[model samples]
Target: MAITKEEVLHVARLARLELNDAEVERFQGQLSAILEAVGKVAELDLSDVPPTSHPLEVSNAWGEDVPHTSLTQDEAFANAPERDDDHFRVPPA
Candidate 1:
């Protein structure tokens, strides 16, 4: 379907845009072509197609989590800009 210049002007107004006559005419044609392309997509038959979030099949490649040695509290806070004996300090929210 063809889009009109008034429709383009109305959309420009809704978006708080200032379009001259030339821009309005240009957008009228461009938006009409876009609507026609989308209309063509709407005419397709896809009754057997399944909706998908991704176009390709996907699977997790990560291995199982393993336990490991961890840093002590003192080591963790060694580089703190402001810290108490047992914890880091921050400005009150």
Candidate 2:
């Protein structure tokens, strides 16, 4: 569908934008052309085309997780900047 100047103005209003008469006319043409391009693309035969989010295969850099020995409480607390026996101490709230 062709986008009218009024439709452009309405969209501008919805977006809280201020457009002059010339700007509205320009946007009406630009947005209409975009719709026309999309419409043309929609007319293409693509029944065999598969839906894909990305053309390339994607994967996480980190590998599968495995159980491993973790640090003990003493080792974890050895490097604390501020600590109270078994817990971190912060400034008064």
Over 11-81, each residue of candidate 1 has an lDDT whose tens digit, in order, gives 99999999999999899999999999989966888687776678668767577799788999888888888
Model 1 stretches astray by more than 4 angstroms: 46-93
**lDDT of each candidate versus the true structure:** 0.88, 0.87
Residue 56 Cα positional deviation in candidate 1, in Å, after optimal superposition: 10
Off by over 4 Å in 2: 48-56, 59-93
**Where does candidate 1 have its weakest 10-residue lDDT segment?**
55-64
Kindly give the stretch of ten consecutive residues in candidate 2 with the minimal lDDT sum: 55-64
